[model samples]
Target: MENPAEVLRRVFGHEGFRGLQAGIVAHVMEGGSGLVLMPTGGGKSLCYQVPALCLPGLAVVVSPLIALMEDQVAALRQQGVAAAALHSDLDEEERFEIRRAMARGELRILYVSPERLVMDGTLDNLARREVSLFAIDEAHCVSQWGHHFRPEYRGLTVLAERFPLVPRLALTATADERTVDDIRRQLVLADAPVFRGGFDRPNIFITAEPRETERAQLRAFIKRASDGRGAGIIYCGSRRKTEDTAAWLKQDGHDAMAFHAGMEASAKREAHHRFARGDAVIMCATIAFGMGIDRPDVRWVAHTDLPKSPESWYQEIGRAGRDGLPAQALLLYGPGDIALGRHRIQESPASDEQKRIERGRLEAIVSIAESATCRRRALLRCFGEDLEEDCGACDACATPPKMWNGTVAAQKMLSAVLRTGQRFGLGHIIDVLRGRMTDKIAQHGHDQLPTFGVGKDLPDHTWRGVARQLVSRGALDVAVENHGELLPTDQARPILKGETQLMLRADTVSKASTPRESSAPERGEDPVFDALRQWRRDEARNQGVPAYVIFQDKTLAEIAYRKPRSLDGLAGVPGVGTSKLDKYGDAVLEVLLEAGA
Candidate 1:
């Protein structure tokens, strides 16, 4: 059998394995089971794919999404590998052909969803074949503590029971310590080695700001980040917001589309198709749109509202910069978003332990948003990884927020919440603090409270910021069952009793200065690069696949920079495997010559 390196070079075109990939491939090839925790775009697929090619029999892969399965199959086929996917979308003829190929040992890899793999007679049929290994993608779904938990994934544990001798690998891009433990226990891979590729995407520039004129902030972010080039995804919290944001962007002359779970299946497919094909399209969507996407040139991702947990936020932002290119992620949120997040956890049917876990996750994300320190460091801490130094890529590291002694302000805010009987929401409490005689304040007789007008020196927005910071600091909580009232937590006692002081970031609309340019190596203006990109776009269009599937932007950039004069010279460039070299190498040389490369 060919070694993993030979398969990687001849098929995948990559010269060498990335971090931990070689170890993972060798382990699986040696009939050892393991768990892999790698960040998105970290070459996690190569870990399993390389071993599957070196192994003896058909390697079965369990994937969660049809789109993900189809995309991988298509890419693998492009490399002249025998790959097939059995999904619900396929017709009977296609399924029959795939089953025949598997039985005849004509296919090297087969992809199936968890539901289909666990169905009656499915495992029985597979048992008849000489199976090599079982790879479970998106393995975090099996854990109840995961952000994207699906009950179907729990059925996957049977793979170990049925194929005890076959090497098994569970892989995910996002998982905390608790979720990791749960995945191991549920999948019964307790004795397997766990390979953790560190969780840091330095190519992604992270930034979060208080929501101030949401449309304006998003528009400015898009312009600054992408300059109207490449693809972007705007995540909204609600279905209606997706539609409204998409429409608004379209009105502003962007090629925008709305996607949500509420859309018809055909509509969602069409939207996904357009996004995959178009170079400069913008997708306004809820969280439903990201997991299945394999497109690598996404230049930016923006969140109009806060994500429910740190895992969700990390995964969502990770969709950008998948090609190891410079990308930006912007998050716009407010106090209401945090309150709603807390309220949802409180109202969930989960047991107290689960609720506590979720609440901690929510608070962790909130800390990331309001943090005055390195955002990347704080984000990595959630996954139990530590960054020794500040990552210069995040907005916080680029432009640190100004912090001030807010002990007096915190006292006033806590006093207002307490004086209002801890039964009023932010708006009403703000009204009382600002000494505004609103009807609700009059009805509650809050104007008579001693804390009334104590904070009148600060503006409404400042007070709102203070309230948000207080909630984040655990000095206050939102009472969702009581109509979103503000309640003090035990941590509030120190500030209320003058036992401790508080330091808060000075919240303002202009907190973030002009962002510094990304530290990533610049792809300078090379006419050769532009011409090659156009040629690639045309070629991809002719083939009816996403442009990146033909060749990633990073590979194209290298080609343009190198200006390889012959097919052999082009093959020397990364991403030019034997299959691609035999297929499109001459065409690439011709384009380069035409462009005076």
Candidate 2:
């Protein structure tokens, strides 16, 4: 068997192993079973991929995505490793050819979806041979309690029972404690030695903005994130958002394409190819678009709307900086997104118990948005990881905002909503707060209410603050279809009656990173700062890699703050791998010394 370091170089053009990768590979090579919880780009695939090559017989791998299977197979084949996939998308001839190759002992790695794995003869065929290993990729989807539940994935354990000789390895990029346990139980890997890699990626700077005009905001986000350079992903929550944003970006003269389940397969494949070949700058897409893309130069991943949960957020942002370059994770949460997310679960065909769990997950997402504490800490906590302080890479860490007591303000808002029968939305409620006397008020005959105009002292923007903070804090929920229809939640009951207090963080504005009038102390870790940019030419270029893969502004800021001078020192600088250091270290050092770092 090739040494793990040699395995990396031979297969993927890397010359070394990251912290836990070698350990994981060794465990698998020794025929031990385990679960792996690693962040994206942590070499999770290599953990099993290397062992498969060293093992005696065909390694049967289960993946949730056909695109992922095909991409992996192509990459493997590119390196002269024999791999093939069996999926529904393959034609009869393609399927038969794959079967023939496996039967002839010509295929080394066989990839199949969980659905195909559960098919009658698929396991029997694998069981007939040595079947060295079974790898479950994106294993988090197997649990019914999981957000991305796939019923077919539950049948994955059938192979484990039939082919007990094969070592099983379950891997996922974003799974919390509950999700990890769910994967273990569903896949029947009871005593697997779980290998957990660090969730902290200091190179990736995270920020969030409340989405106002979602379309307009997303448009502006896409433009600014490009920083006049390499490709990025703008993930929309729905197909309409994807098509509309992709079209608008094209009209705005950006080289963009749309990818979604709603599009034709050929179009989807074309878009994926265009993105991989660096022909597209931004691919406007729904959740369906990002599953298996292997491109590593993506500089940014922006969520135009809030995702269903932190796991979803982690997975989406994971796509960026795969080549170990610094990336930006810019998330936009429209106030309306919470209701939509919850209503999605509420409307799902599930048992009441499942609905309750789903609702809790949605509520947890909203807390992530509103929390003034460290955003990364809160997120890591959700996934059973604990970080003591703010992660300087996130918004809360970069710009510390102030908190104001909004307990009185929340009481007043809830009183008004309930006093008025809870039928009207924010617009009407705002009107009553400002003492605006209009025909609509008289038509509804709400003017005579005791709470009418009682909130005249609060400004319109202040009222906006009260509303935004309340929703963030879970005192209220907007109607899913009618986001305008704000309703008090059970949480609001005690607060409205003056039983509880609300202290909301005063919103802070983060300025763009440019030469400020006076230098402010820097916060993030970017080895190259002080020097201004070279040109606004095409991004994702330099040293045979994409531009976004270089150094993001936030990372640059961090580097400017903590000037590291050695390889080990620079290694702590987010995204500065041995490969990156070998390629760009001198240039970065020149910038640092020139800037007096």
Candidate 3:
């Protein structure tokens, strides 16, 4: 068997391992199992892919989605490795071919969906051959409480029962402490060594704005973020919102498409194909779209509504800058989102324990949105990680927002809710506070209430911010059966009594500051880098593959910056393996030399 490092450089074209990758690979190579929690684009695949190549038998990789399996197998095949994915999408002949290859030990790695792998006789076939190991990707799916729970993933424990000697590796891009523990229990990986990689993605600039005009803010953000030169994803909360937003973008002359589980399979497939194959296209989608996407060059991710939890938000935003380039993540939320989210949770039939856990998760995300501290710091804290210093890339650290003590405002809002018998929504409460003598106020009798019009000096947005912050801070609650009417919680008693002070971001109408333009000079400014990218794209198209499959943008940028003059020099750069050096080195050198000339 080949060494892991040798396989990494020769096949994947990376010079060495990153973070816990080396240690994890060694453990697995010694027939040990482990659970790996790494950030998106943090090279999680190498933990398994390298070990699969180094091991003896057919490495069975349990993947959740067919698209993810297909993409991974495609990239591995490009490196001259014998890899194949078995899924429902394949024809009988293709399945037979793959089966024959596995039987003959011609395949190094075989990707199978969890459902298929757990089917009757699947383990029998693998047992006939030298089954090297089992790798479970998206292992967090086993956690029933996780954001993207897959019941099928829980059945993956069978791999350990049947193939007792085969090492198992479970990998995920996002998981909190609870999800991690649940994964261990469900996937039977408790005995496996756990490797927790850093959750930080400094390459992605995080910013969120309180919704003013949702569409207008999104349009401006798109203009500022990608400038129509890169690809991106815009996440909408509902299926209808995704379709409408996509249609709106198309009308604005953007090359955009809508994708959601609600769409027909063929239509969703077409949309996925277009975004994967083309550059600078915007995909307006629900949360259904990104989990299986392996496209590495996506430049930005935007959310038109609140993500359910900090974990989900971080994973969604982590999709950007997968190629290690600068990227942006922008979220726009309003009080309605908070209300809607609470209503959804309250109306659900989930167990009380699950609901309580989910509510805590939601509150954490709300805190991140309303935070005056570093966005990265708040986000990382939710996952049990901490940054010693603020990340200068996020909106808060870039331009500190002004904060004001909202203790008095909190008391007024809570008093209005209480005095109104806690039967009104924010709008009615705001109307009461602004002293609007509407028919409803008159009918409720006597604008003589002590709290009415007390908030007249505050703008509508300011009041909205205060109310949402109260809900986020547990001082206020939304009554589910009452159409999300505001109600004070026990926590509100302290704040109302002046024992607990509330501090909130003051400029409610002001948006989060846009991240500074990347200080590193644009790659396009270097002709050789541009030429190399063009060459990679052409090569990728000719081979019918994604450009990153040929060489990552990071690798190409390094090549351009180093301007290697010979094949030997090119081989010395990261991502230039012996095979790639032999296949494309001359072509790359010619492009670089011609650009220099």
Candidate 4:
């Protein structure tokens, strides 16, 4: 049997394992079942992929989406591995070819969707083969309480019941304590040791902005992120918003595309193909777009509306910086998002217990958004993991948001909510605070109230920001039963009575990075870097792969900086694996020599 380390170095192109990866790989190779919780790009696939290669038989990988399965299979095949995906998308001939390869014992890894795996006769056929192991990707989907729960994932438990002798490995990038427990119970991996790689993506600089002029904010962030350079994904809350955003970006002269579940199947595939193969394309999409995407040079990820939970937010942002380059995660959410999120929880058909748990999770997300300290620290702490100190990468750590004593603002919001009977929502209370003498106010006799117009000095968005912080801090609560009305909590008494001090962020987005630290190139570009990127783009196009799949931005940067003169010199760059070096060595050297001339 080939050693796992040899497989990693030769096939995957990495020198060695990172953190808990080696332990997990060895455990799986020793025929032990387990659960893996590693952040994206933390090499979760290697835990199972390496063991599958070292073992004797075919390893069945149960993935969530067909696109993801196909991407993994292609990337693996590029490394001289015999891997194939058996999803519904395959034609009869393709399916027959895969079956023939399997029957001939010519395949090492196979990817299948959970829906197809549980179908009748699928396992029976697999039982006839010498199955090595089972890998469940996106295992968190099995948790009914998770944000991205899939009903089909629950049926995966049969893998254990039917193939008890085969080691089963489940992997996910985002799962809170509850989600992890749920995954374990659902997957029936009772005795399997859980290997947690920690919930930290230091490569991604996280920031959140209040949703005032969200369109303009998103545009500015995307402009700074791509800067006519790398690719990115702009996540919207709705399909219409994605379409409109994509169109607007195209009008603004960006090479942008729109992707959503509402699009035609062929359109979706085309969009995916364009993004996977094209350069510097800004994909305006809903959350449904990125799950299975393997594009590695994504410079940033922006959310025009807030994500439902920290787990969802983490997973979305993790998509960026997969190549370990500096990437940005900019989230823009407004006061409306809070009410909408609570309303969603209320409207859900979940049991009261589930609703209460979801309500807590939503509040935690709000806390992270409104956090005044280091954003990365707050995010890690959300998953019950703590950072020893503040990380300097996040927007807050680099350039902290200016904060002001918001006690008076908090008091005013609480007073307005109370004086208005606490039955009205944020919009109504804001109207009352700003002295809007609309018919509703006059009809309710609220125009005559003393709190009316008392907060007129503050802008509506500013007051909304204040109210959002208060709610996040527990001074105010959304009354879901009464159509998202604002109500005072016990914590409100301290602020209302001037016993507790409050501070609110004055601005939404943090200061932009300096030219040296930004993902965008400075005005004066490095000729070698540009030349190498051009070469990589051309090579990727010829090979029908994403540019990052051929050579990540980080690798190109290293090659340019070193200006390697020989194939041996080029081989020393971190991302230049044996397969890539053997194929692109001469081309990279030529680009370097020409640029130096």
Best by TM-score: 1
- TM match of model 3 to true structure: 0.92
Better of 2 and 4 by lDDT: 4
TM-score for all models, in order of appearance: 0.94, 0.81, 0.92, 0.90
Candidate 4 runs further than 4 Å off = 414-449, 456-461, 473-524
Whole-structure CA lDDT of model 4: 0.83
- Lowest summed lDDT across 10 adjacent residues in model 2 is found at 513-522
Q: Rate the local accuracy (lDDT) of all candidates.
A: 0.88, 0.73, 0.85, 0.83
Candidate that scores best on lDDT: 1
**Could you give candidate 3's per-residue lDDT for residues 451-483 as a string of tens digits?**
989999999898988887887676787774558
lDDT of 4 at 169: 97
Which 10 consecutive residues of model 1 have the lowest summed lDDT?
510-519
Q: Model 4: how large is the Cα RMSD against the reference?
A: 3.3
lDDT of 1 by residue, 1-597 (tens): 888999998888888999999999999888899999999999999988898899888999999888778778878877888999988888989888988988888999999999989987779889999899999999999999888898999998898888899999999999988899999999999999999999999988899998878888887898888844479999999999999999989999999999999999889888988988898899999999877888888999999999999999999999998888888899999877887888788778999999998888888899899999899999999988999899888888888888888999889888888878888888888888889988988888888999888888988878888988888777888875568789899999989888988888888764454545665555777888888889889988898887888888888989998999988788889898999899899889999999998
**Which sections of candidate 1 miss by over 4 Å?**
414-457, 478-493, 513-519
Could you tell me the TM-score of candidate 4?
Answer: 0.90
Local accuracy of candidate 2 as per-residue lDDT tens digits, 294-397: 76657788898888877888888889776565677777775568767777887899899878877777777778777676777877877778887666777676
Q: State the displacement of the C-alpha of residue 375, model 3, in Å, after optimal TM-score superposition.
A: 2.2
